[model samples]
Target: MIEKELPLFPLNLVAYPGEELNLHIFEPRYRQLITECVNNNTTFGVPSYVLSKIEYGTEVRIVKLEKTYDDGRMDVRTVGMGIFKVLDFVSPWPGKLYAGGTVEMIKADHDGDVVLQEELFKLANDLFEWLGMEGLVKFDQKMLTYAIAHKIGLSKEQEYELLKTTSEKKRQEFLINYLKLTIPIVKQMEQAKDRIRQNGHFKHLDALDF
Candidate 1:
């Protein structure tokens, strides 16, 4: 439904659709890439570089070009439009300094199971509350994965796994499993931290009822 050969920006992190990532364009190739996208009002592909290969990426558009330095570098803000799978890589992009690639946009299902959505929020809120980030997630549209993907603790490979999965229910299941596994450990860590903080405090010990 969009351009097939989009400019490629391979980075160490994963880019999820509907998320905003601000980037500094210091490299010559990327500067050209950002400039061209701004001029054409086009979208580019941000394939995550994992294990030294490019497979999956997110399609993003330059919504705003915040600044252009005197030296020609730029600071631009981009929002991910959708996910994509690279079909082919074009190094130097046939007259471009940066890489370009043929990619097919992968559709993300926004609808999630209501029960699962609730559970995801419950668990997410627990983690956030413990971390003092209680209001971080706004869950709606049944897109619980989108709401929690970036915020929840997930490695780059784990994030890419989410991108590979197109089903909403499955993604929710994956996240649920993740949270169920993670919350206990986080709870233990928090408990240990509290104990550490209370190390020197004098406590009024009530008679222990065993």
Candidate 2:
């Protein structure tokens, strides 16, 4: 396992590998962190929030950084694709929120058969259509996968489960299962909405039968 000390950023949200996270760095410390990353060409770790503790986060590379203010604030967009295991942490100050930790990178093996990826994309597309989001068909397969995964309603724990897997084949399988469960729920919700509309309960009526 490749290990190194990394800066930890705990967010209220969970970001999966191959997902995009846009952050507004306004705090002085984080702004400093961002500046150091941009200047040094380094990446940072983002641990998933779990039951009041953050143990896993994806290592993200900064794709674009835009200066939004003269006071060291930035509008930065990053893509997360690397998983890291937290080894140790230190919170030097009590009130300070950020902490530093040692991390080991978890490299994923993408050597799986391409046929599996193709089939997964097909299933994902079908799920999107079933959810009445056929408009997403225009997006590239990778983007479509990411979009659907975001909509799967996985909790932070479930997302961390996906993040920790090192095999592409297993990740695809998990995602297929998630799509199976989520697509039906979305369809049921849509059916309920259709029922409510067909009943005309929300429409203005000319008169009511007495």
Candidate 3:
């Protein structure tokens, strides 16, 4: 396990591996942390929210940083790709939402299989059309994968399960199953809506004559 002390950013949402996160640094302490990461060749960890603080998070690398103000406020975008276990943490001194934690990096298989990639792309395209989100499809493999995964409505825990799996083949299989289950439900809902619209009444209501 590769262990390192990393600054933690607690968010209301969970970020899965191979996902992108955008943050605006405004607080003084987070501003300090951002400055440190920018100055040094360093990455930060984001743990899944467990109660108050996150005990498991993803390691995020800074991709872009924009200086917005003379006094240190900035806009930044980071790509989260690695899963890490949080060992310890310190509370924000006061008026800060972020925390710092000791973490151990978890290695994952980066060798994605081409076959699985192609299959996932196909399923993603099918899902996009099924959900009537065809215009949103980017056709880029990575973006498509993430967008479909999110659109299929995986829970935070389920997303964590996907991130922790070290096999690309396994991840691809999991995504396929998820889409299979969710797509039917979405289609059923659409059908029910159509029925309601045709009858001019809620689906649960008995048909009545005017």
Best by TM-score: 1
Query: Per-residue lDDT for 81-193 in model 3, tens only?
Result: 77887888777623444577678888776566678788777767777787788867575665434445665668877776776676766777888888778778878888888
lDDT of 2 by residue, 1-210 (tens): 899877677776677777889999998777767777889998888887765776777888899995568776899999987778777866632344456778888887655446656766676777768677776555354443334456655776676677677776787778777777777787888889888888946676689688
Candidate 3 local distance difference test against the native: 0.73
lDDT for model 2, on a 0 to 1 scale? 0.73
- State TM-scores per candidate: 0.91, 0.79, 0.77
Question: Any residue pairs clashing in model 1, and if so which?
Answer: none
Candidate 1's displacement at residue 44, Å, is 1.0
4-60: candidate 1 lDDT, tens digit per residue? 889999998888888889999899999989888888888898998975888888988
- Candidate 3 wrongly placed segments (more than 4 Å): 50-53, 70-72, 92-98, 112-119, 139-148, 200-210
Better of 1 and 3 by TM-score: 1
Model 2, C-alpha of 48: deviation from truth (Å): 1.6
| lDDT for 156 (candidate 2) | 65
